[model samples]
Target: MSVAELRPNMDFWQERVDMAAAFRWTERLNMHEGVANHFSLAVNDDGTQFLMNPNQMHFRRIKASDLLFLDANNPKTLEGPDAPDPTAWGLHGSIHRRCPHARCVMHVHSTHATVLAALADSTLPPIDQNTATFYNRYVVDNQFGGLAFEEEGERCASMMSDPKVKTMIMGNHGVLVIGSSVADTFNRLYYFERAAETYIRALQTGQPLRVLSDEIAEKTAQELEDYPEQDVRHLNELKAILDEEGSNYAS
Candidate 1:
């Protein structure tokens, strides 16, 4: 039968559609590594049960029906036929298990973000409005363990304990962002890369950087946080464009 007929009562269909759209758009923006990055969203209370991308799948080809349902509390998750990537399971799984506030988590090794991560300091300063949006709202993880196995995942998860910190600059690695929903997290991830790009380009200019004041940066951050429905609208508009192009992301 057809794909829809195979799964008649797909749970969290809208969430899955939004996530698939995010994946497609991220790939279009060249923010995804070669079948490496992963995105996840919590579906149950306490955030232990979640949905994640299938193992080694390219973001551009992901569909709503392809997400993997998993539980952080389940020991046999990795033994199943539909098991996720080890590092995805380790990092996203650990975050969901420990940080209930992080309902949605996205991890990617996008170029500019990874470049910032490779720096000794690995901090995103408030240089412009986009950069200011993340002022005092992110954590820097200097500890770069080899691959994100269970131990490394747990260690990284611990750094996200603070609800105020929505982004993590994974030193010598990549970037991880968490939010209450797919749109929120994806929007944060998108802007973060843009901000990193601006900062990196500024450094390349070798000119004096005009940094925003702490007061103004904090104010701008608060304003953006209070700005209503920007994240939701952002994703919705993207989905609209995808629909116009007859993309199969939602299928």
Candidate 2:
């Protein structure tokens, strides 16, 4: 559809479509494990309520309008046919309630992230540009006292307060990334998983891993200020690949 011809509500529908697309894309990329992963996006401008995948649907089966609209302030989820998973409630609900700046939150337990999380030292070494994308903008939450619940989620909110840190390594759990949009979150999540995989594999090689100096790593990360436009191109390319394979993603 032509940009000029798009409706005023296009952004709303597009957000839903893209949110659904992120879930399906994660599954296709092997980034989801059953119904474990949770992805959320704040709705409207004030960022009170958010969009999240329904309680039990596998990532592949998610549809645009099928998402649940949840209120962050209300402790009890609105009476609905599709309640969100309890863990999702614990993780995303706390974020939405506590982190107003976190408009979009993504949590996943993909192979690489889980692998890195399992490490005694789950810190990502600045090995390359991709690994350097986070630089000081990532946190290692070493204290994983079971799933995020009650005080635990509140603990997460405190630990995840830095605006610069787009991603967090929930030690012994998985990865969490926040963005202004699903495209941004997914892009960061994708690169983070790949970067972690690269970091771990390089360590396995047993060669002295070349680590970038903090100054250079910070510089490289600053260069990623261009990533908003860069990420649009990247996400479009990935979307095209998925479209070629199947168009069921946003339906």
Candidate 3:
């Protein structure tokens, strides 16, 4: 589904809850980097307004109501009392503004993905079905400017604006997964790191890799793309765990 499709009688509050759960689960999975890294979901029908975590808040402790609402086009948002991390606003704001297809975005520096990013050939080799999911579906931001201020964010946004790009492997940095929904984006984020881990582990072995042929890899990727709505179910299961464990994320 598309961002426009996500609008109309939508429950923005429910979106907050879902996004907060994503944060908590990311923390549980040890994917968070202190108070850094950010995720955002567009709240507006046009995808210009979004919800982001406030600066310096640990993901595990974030609650649904703790999310900050800001407009992508509003320059004065940074001056507000609940201003988001500059890098968060820069990266997420630009993407939500320029790439409507990217209604939900997950940016992280998970261990394996970051390890892969640091390598000279950072492209994810299609050695298995998991790695094939991103066969031709990702972009590589080879230039790693210091922090992602608005300028760097704009550059990143432009890279993702291309309709074909669903994942971005930032050289010397990490990964960014974009999708139409938080569930889909989160699932992709989880699997992309899994794929990276597989690649890194294979590299650690002294033997050469038996990489998949381009024909087989592309076929597997398309099949993965055609797979049904498991992401929504995945998010539902996650929320159920939070409900049973505690409801801190729901607020």
Candidate 4:
């Protein structure tokens, strides 16, 4: 059968496709960390139920049908045949269960973001438009209490309690971002990495930095947030490119 013919007509099919495309594109951007990181999307009204990538799967190879549907409240989730990675279950489950507003969660150990996270100040200054986009919008988790098991996950989720904070600079760890959808979250993740790269490269130059004023930074952030359909268009164009290349992500 053709890939389209075998596609499942289940709930959240489009969400799965979008998420798979995000995964593929993330890999293409060299943002994925081997088979370690994860992405999840809430599938239920309360966000307790969600979909996640299968355990240890590489982003480039993940198809829409390969996602695992999970319930954060279910204790037996980790014991199933298609069980997710423990850290994924712990981190994503905590977010989905505690933060209903965070409909989608993406975690990565991308190079620049992780470097920023490792810094003593883990702060992204408003150096330029890209960096300014995240001004005062991210929370820095200074406490790195090992891997994201249940307790660690709970602590991380606690920091995201503020409705306005959509990104977390996981201190000594990686980065985590949440949004209303896959496109929005992935877009944030992509830009955050780009912003981090810019900041890091600037720091390496040893030259005096030209930082934006707080007022202008906030204004830029707000303007970028309100930009029309950029996130949707970004993901659509990526999916179109994948389709043209005969990628199986949507399958």
Candidate 5:
């Protein structure tokens, strides 16, 4: 089919479908804050364009086709038909402009992750095997100066200097995770949330915690390098759960 006759490319459609599924799945995990939070991915090799949900669209109400194809380099992007939320624009647009390595970016205020973010010291403890995935793979930006203004995106971009570090505790805001694709980012986010929840729960118990030794944690982190498709499998399992429950975010 011709470009005018046919729909967008398969890659574009797949990004929409996969991201919508992620939003729905995150909602079920109680990671959504009504209509807040945003996830985006670059549409092409260049970081000029991206795909993200429109403003005010709740996660449960989001569909693949509802996503807006936003051009970060466009002068009139904020005035477009499906304009993005201000914070989304401020944060995502900045990263896309400055951070070429982040193909996909997901920001959320999940319960445990947000709680951890508010802590005076925003470091994830290597207390368990799950937490080890982020061993020496995160950056804690201590400067929380109100909402993420337009200028703030560039600052966040600067802090994300390492491509290998997928996780970023956005000061007092929340958590941001990036990956080469939506599936990879979502998988990391899910595991990161789990790790945060585990540590927070242990803190609540008021008992002595069993923290992993640095040598063991470092070894586990290295072993995790072999699981290149770990995120793919984890996402498939979540999709299966949605299928069993009749949530048609993919459809």
Candidate 6:
């Protein structure tokens, strides 16, 4: 559809469709682990109000209309019939509530990323171009207090407040990536897994890793940041594929 075709009133619907598409695409890419992980996008500027997947819903079957709206400060979310997963509410909700820059949050336990997270040293070494994409721009939260219950979730969200850091390797847990938009966040999540895979493979080689210098790594990261608009195209193409595949994600 052309830009002119998107009515101003349909902004919320469009964002929902885009977010649902991200969920389906993540499933297709094998990044989803059953119904375990969560993805959320803020609907309001303050980030306190957001959309998240309902509890126990598989990512592959998530519909645009199935997402639940939540307020970070609403403690009643945990007691309702339509309540979200506690951990999801805790982690995604708290981040959305506290970090205005984190408009989109994608948390996953994809194999490679989780593997890296499991390591004592969970930092992604700048050993390749993909790794360099996150060099000096990622943070590590080495505290793992099990599930992100209310307080634990707040702690995790606090670790993600730095706008300069888009990716957070949740030590002994999984990975959390945030962005100002769903497409950007999903794109980062996609590439992060690939980078983690490559890093793990290189480590398996048992050879001394040829790490990049700080100057080069910083330059490459800046270059990657400059090309942020490509994520929209990437997401659009994925949506096009879903359109052809008779997806019910937007239903």
Q: Judged by TM-score relative to the true structure, which candidate is superior, 4 or 6?
A: 4
Task: Look at candidate 5 and give me any clashing residue pairs.
Answer: none
Task: Give the TM-score comparing model 5 with the true structure, all chains together.
Answer: 0.91
- Ten-residue region with minimum lDDT total, candidate 6: 2-11
Error of 2 at 43 (Å): 1.1
lDDT of 1 by residue, 1-251 (tens): 55456457998888899999999999999999989999999999999999999999999999999999999999999998889999999999999999999999999999999999999988888999999999999999998998998899999999999999999999999999999999999999999999999999999999999999999999999999999999999999999999899998988
**What does candidate 4's lDDT look like per residue over 1-251, in tens digits?**
55446664666788899999999999999999999999999999999999999999999899998999999999999998999999999999999999999999999999999999999999999999999999999999999999899889999999998878999999999899999999999999999999999999999999999999999999999999999999999999999999999998987
Q: What TM-score fits each model?
A: 0.97, 0.91, 0.94, 0.97, 0.91, 0.95
lDDT of 1 at 159: 98
**RMSD list, candidates in order:** 2.2, 2.5, 4.1, 1.7, 2.8, 2.2
For all candidates, what are the clash counts?
A: 0, 1, 0, 0, 0, 0
Better of 3 and 6 by TM-score: 6
| Residue lDDT tens for model 6, 173-224 | 8899999899899989999999999999999999999999999999998999
lDDT of each residue in 131-171, candidate 5, tens digit only:
98789989998987777767787788788768878899987
Model 4 bad stretches (over 4 Å): 1-8
lDDT of 5 at 26: 89
Q: Could you tell me the C-alpha RMSD of candidate 6 in Å?
A: 2.2
**lDDT scores for all predictions?**
0.95, 0.83, 0.90, 0.94, 0.84, 0.90
- Model 2: per-residue Cα lDDT over 48-87, one tens digit each: 6899988878998887777888887776673555778877
Name the candidate, 4 or 6, with the larger lDDT value.
4
Clash count in backbone of candidate 3:
0
